[model samples]
Target: MDKNEFLTVDEIIELTGFKKQSCQCEALTANGFSYAKDAEGRPKLTWTHVNAVLNGQINVVAYENERPNFGAI
Candidate 1:
């Protein structure tokens, strides 16, 4: 596996500061982040996804267990 290929669950957790995959998944979904699942059916955020979030290329409205407030949208 390439070192720059994909971001693991732990890496994503640390990067996004979420405790679990479900929480991270919800955040990613809210922010329109596209990721893939591992062989064990776990979500793996790719480098692109991380970069987009970190670099502000994408809208990350939530972190650390705070869900996006879609306020009647």
Candidate 2:
């Protein structure tokens, strides 16, 4: 857990408990996203991607609140 190191996909998944294909990882590699993969393919997602995903900047649709039906109102 040093500043020079990062977690792998499984680690991130375990830390965040985010399901597979969630934006926690996808947000890392996304264009214009806070972080990207290093040459070794490890993401700085812990700092950048996790927050964005939590804040709805990425992978938002999956966590949406269910729309309420008003009975044709």
Give me the runs in candidate 1 sitting further than 4 Å from their true place: 1-3, 56-73
TM-score against truth, every candidate: 0.55, 0.29
Q: Score residue 40 of candidate 2 by CA lDDT.
A: 56
Q: Model-by-model lDDT, in order?
A: 0.69, 0.53
Regions more than 4 Å wrong, model 2: 1-10, 13-34, 57-73
- Against the true structure, candidate 1 has what lDDT? 0.69
Q: Which candidate is the best by lDDT?
A: 1
Candidate 1 to native Cα RMSD, angstroms: 6.4
- Across 1-73, the per-residue lDDT of candidate 2 in tens digits comes to 5563555667666654565544555643333334555775454555555557667776544433343457768
Model 2: lDDT equals: 0.53
Residue range with the least summed lDDT across 10 consecutive positions in model 1: 60-69
Cα lDDT tens digits, model 1, 4-35, are 67876678787657867778777766666767
